[model samples]
Target: MTTLPDHYEIVRERNGYGSADGAVGPVPAAERRRFVAVDDEGVFDRADRRRTLVATGVGMTGPPHLGTVGQFLTAVALQEAGLDVQFVLADLEPYHGGAPLDRVRRLAERYRTFALDLGFDPDRGRLRTQEGAREVMHTAQLLAPYYDPDRWTEDAGDDSGDTDPPPTEWERAVREAYEAGEDDRRSGTAAVARPGPSSEAADIHSAVLHGADFLHPLYAGDYERLVLQFGVDEHHLVGMARRFRDAAAVEGGVAGLYTRMIPGFDGTPKMAKSIPGAGVSLATSADEIRERIAGDPGGDPARSPVFQAMCLASRYDAERLGRLERACEAGDETWDRARSEYAEFVVGLAERWRATEE
Candidate 1:
């Protein structure tokens, strides 16, 4: 496995993002580096902090996991750095994958309460569901013409110059369907609604909604810029939005900050909600969470989900985490000790928030 730093460097180069070496107020370069990459540091440096909105979200198909919690905390970090933040609960995005609206809404409510427990202040910013946001829905419709189905299909073909192929329309449809099925499995429901018949239309529709998800604040809230934070795999979504922003000649620009992913315990590339038992979640019992974290014999800190959780999700400072990493790499007992502590941290968080009546 690639070391964490080396992995992020490769991703930054591949996506044409600048080196993650800048500070947001007292946030510092080392702290920003935790996110891995950004579309342009200059965009961030130039923006008026009060007028810029830092946006991030997760699909409302399930409970919060380590990866998603990390994202929410990252948003809070930016808010602490003196910028406005918007944490979207993408209730509508998963409807394309066949997630029932009622079930999705319930998950969104739970997620909202959980985010508050994790320290997101609505007084400083916003946390909203896409389905309830009529302005965003209207903006999505306005931007619908900017998406081109033919171009995306061509880009996914064999003749394309890109080494990494974009997901074909059918592949995206299948992915959504699978995610919807995961929702069903997690909720213990046998049957549920699915997307519309045309896979191509569903794919394009999703792209449009995504574009609006990024731009609606700029359009409706009158924010001057958007700094989108997402996992590296979703870089294409940022690219698509950038293209739309340019084609439509929108007033403000959209910049990106990409973060590293934790490999799933089940051996998938990233810890994903669509896969059962892939990573630790706040909804499970304390002993069960510890068993899941400790039972896995993670060989190296770079490859360990526990260490990645500490880096991404926990409030561990950069210095402490760096020391732990170096010590673990030198083949000491640091990793064993650190992993036990991380397990307890996660268990405590779960007990505190998941037990809430809300």
Candidate 2:
């Protein structure tokens, strides 16, 4: 909510943005393009001359939750719109994110299965696992020399305007990772669980590496068009595409599609695994999903996780969604009834995902 981008107006209506904000208008007929670091380019329309790739990824540090599924659903919408979509399993960063080795390994393996369950098209889009494809690490290594520690601090603070946060111990470790040749990485022994100051520090290095990992491969391979879909807050990583000197638009300059962060089920800031009762697991029972949704104290219509669920789930059923919206506007018992419908919508999605897995 800090600021809206130009593309936000166009893509927001595709129903993938998943905000409770009333629809401004249906997506207008326009030339297919995306927001680059400092420019917008007509890239998607020129697929005949060169291949187009739309990619989004998540760190495998936790189970796929409602938030995770929401991101995947948005990716699916992009694919449906004829964007070449790819799902990246960012399994590498958790290793440096201060997560335990066993936990990181487990989550990395588990995330792929759940991602498959979430209905990512295996035929159309490939799961670019960082573990399997060392391109993530290899790319990071190639781009590491470009960033000195000072600019590193600046690039890391892109999300926070004006105020640059203090450095944490994890940042020192990330710096060491940069200095230490690829063969000499001592990250495994030094890594610790991300919490408090450690999480903040771990994030800076993770962002640098993740960005390079994403773009370098495409750049090296000479991809004609690359669309990067990531968490809205992580746009700085996408901006790394511009860091390369003298690279023309034809060398696959990256465009960004940042997915909106889904709020927690209990209306806490963001849906996170570390926060208790804040996340609804993809495999949670319908009863459990209802219970979690009901736990939200409905003070603000906008903040209500139920309403957010409706925003996302409505993609599957527009008629029911319209009815729920009308009920909420009317107020009283009808509004209360809409809650159950929202719950039903979420449960139905979970059910479909489960059924498909079975």
Candidate 3:
């Protein structure tokens, strides 16, 4: 069995929250959230013994994108801090609704290779696909019923009619299959739900709300099961997990995943995937990275996607980062060079950081 670090207690206490009761009032949000903190000041004193950490998210299909890069950088920092980190590729999620099976598989392979090339240790960590995980489908099924629009009504005075309508008998059957632990049924249900994009924000909202409500409760049960199987204490992790699970349930879907929505390059409320020049992908070639920075609609590379990518990448030198910002503002001759320099710098820094542990 893996022994947890002494610092796990402190980190857990700092990040803990209470579990949710599905029918009751909503769960309260906690002040401090769980995260692996690492900087020049060094890793948290208690983090020395943390052997494994997991970073799981949906794979990129539109373009290999910078969001994936951000996640990998996060994993890299954890590994540099001496903790084992696993990158779980949630390919099943995209396969369910966003991307075709072949596209999803292709992206997963590319992402795995990118991660390996960038420094993730193949021995200590892996890029796993959720397609093989029966639990994900099972969980997806159990949560499907809560997504019924009839289960919730929109708040009075709210103009956005984003809440899902009542579930059809078909939807209920899908949920039943999931609840009964029918993996094949759950997968089939997910496969059927996978096509087409919703026309409005409200439609998207409704779908997310249902998914969150269903998944949160199901996750809580899974958490308890894991605690028992691993013989780990449920005190610290349970509360936060429950809070997120409940909030996701209440809000209805993955939309609640972002407690605070980040602004896009143009200072818009929503980031546009259609604007390729406005975003950066993890698989973005060096030339593409530079071109995007130069074409930023904001004209200020400091607040551009390039800068945002650097911040998320967390590999650029702090002093250099500031200089890059100032150079952009001043319209200095080195501004163009700064973009290339920063990208190369981050790539090298990530490589070095990943290599130290091995």
How well does each candidate superpose onto the true structure, as a TM-score?
0.82, 0.67, 0.50
The regions of model 1 sitting more than 4 angstroms off are 1-6, 23-26, 150-204, 296-299, 356-358
- Report per-prediction Cα RMSD to one decimal: 5.0, 9.3, 14.9
Give every collision pair in model 1. none
Off by over 4 Å in 3: 1-54, 135-277, 281-289, 296-302, 343-358
lDDT (tens digit, per residue) of candidate 1 on 96-177:
6666767777777888888888889899988988878788888989877776654343233322225554454423543654
lDDT of each: 0.70, 0.54, 0.40
Candidate 1 lDDT trough over 10 residues, lowest sum: 152-161
Total backbone collisions for each predicted model: 0, 1, 16
- Find the number of clashing residue pairs for candidate 3: 16
Give candidate 2's error at residue 193 in angstroms: 7.0
Q: How far off is residue 232 in model 1, in Å? A: 1.6
Misplaced by over 4 Å in model 2 are: 1-50, 98-102, 152-208, 244-250, 265-267, 283-286, 295-301, 317-322, 331-337, 344-358
Per-residue alpha-carbon lDDT of model 3 for 14-115, expressed as tens digits? Answer: 333121112111111111111222111121222323421333343444544454555565455545545444466656545555467788777677666667
Q: List the residue pairs that clash in candidate 2.
A: 98-192
Candidate No. with top lDDT: 1
